[model samples]
Target: MKIVVSGQMLKYQVRNSSTSRSSPSSYGTASPSSSSSNGSQHDVTLLTTSRSNSLVSLNSLDSSGPEGDWGVLKVYTSDIRQCTDYKTIRVSTKTTARNVIEMVLTKFKLTCRDPNLFELWMELTTKAEGKPVKTILRLENDAKPLELQRCHPAGMSRFLLHMNATGTLVRVYDHNICAASNYKSLMLSSLTNCEEAIDLILAQNRKSREESANYGLFLTTPEAEAQIPPEVSIVSVYVLSQPQHKIVIRPLDSL
Candidate 1:
């Protein structure tokens, strides 16, 4: 249980290499070969930036102001890229990313697979809480709880759990239970020891997936008494999409 979340500081730099290369902002882009690549026909071209970065705080999820009634997301499962068992889920913006992907395949019991060949890649961002994270909608399995809370993302607690086409990346866990004086906050700008800060605070969450309180990523600490200048390096996080956000790859009916 190693959780150290202080302020923030990594000065933005993520590319441990998921094949690197990703661009085209307004937070949307999927085709990182996340397992054999089959669905393509999702097109969106909007970087014209004049004013568009607060879809009610990107559909709100405790950005500390609007979103409420459960909105926490951040899951990671890596096979070759090498990150593991990191979860922070708290559904209900009316739920249904296929019931949160069958609640992450029944919180990893495999829920007997075939949840329509699995696909819930809804990663998009640009409410500029410091942009960088990106992964467009790849949800299509009749997903629409108002299009999954309008592809929500206000800040912290991200998502990803691909094991579909055997690209490997599998390691999901989220029983959603949070507590301990409103927990969830581990945003260190730079930490060194304690087993790499307990795998970056359990790789950003999951000491039994609990979020009945703290409202996520400690809402960006940064009070530091007085000596300012130390806020950057949240590894990478972004979410704000609705260029109609849609990407689907469903065609594996053959076992």
Candidate 2:
């Protein structure tokens, strides 16, 4: 007699034969009618099946559905404005005036400008019977004035206040000398003495540190330095009439 088997049936038969031992008692010969009936049936049982494979196929179709565009496009918002306080402690004598100025400007988010103002002065003082004696001495009067200039780089504005000297008293002046300018007004009378100036700068630094500790600066790293934007550059930085002050201006991008 002739027997016909489908591919699936043949595969199943081969797999079962290889993986399982069939005992004579377990295998009974089918009746002639039953064998003929099974041969007439077209349905074939799968040898291997899994619900997980079917689920994977369904998930793939869902991933590429109509909403797929949402996944492809990303939306971003501008970074929030950062609140910067201050950092670093700089001591300026005659020689280090420029260095101190640069350090302070960088710390305080100030930029350098051309024709920049840079001046250095000392508040000389001597102790009297019960009080103190004080006087102001301009470094320029005693020696060659330090080089104060504005630096205008592509996309950034900066002012450079430099003096190559030993420890001496120094004060910064900027283009906006009047009390109206935020930067000028804030630094004026606010700092009357060396100790006061140092204390003020340190206070700002401490405030910054405290803000960072509280996560008020909205920055991932508080100690990270600020980079000047490329669009703006320094315009000018020069010493104003003020004896120990400097001023500078730059493009808005410098901020």
Report the error of model 1 at residue 216, Å: 27
RMSD of 2: 37.4
Q: TM-score of every model? A: 0.21, 0.20
| Count of clashes, each model | 19, 45
User: In candidate 2, what are the lDDT values of residues 1-255, reduced to their tens digit?
Assistant: 123332221211112112222221111222221121343222112211111342223323322333332211010101111232223242312323444444444554553211123333322223333222222222332231121111112212111122222222233322222243333222223113322332233333333322222221010123342322222221211111233333222222333
Runs of candidate 2 exceeding 4 Å displacement? 1-95, 141-255
Instruction: Estimate the TM-score for candidate 2.
Output: 0.20
With candidate 2 superimposed using the best TM-score fit, by how many Å does residue 111's alpha carbon deviate from the native? Answer: 2.1
What's model 2's overall lDDT? 0.25
* Tens-place lDDT digits, model 1, residues 83-129: 34545567655454567667766676654344444555544543223
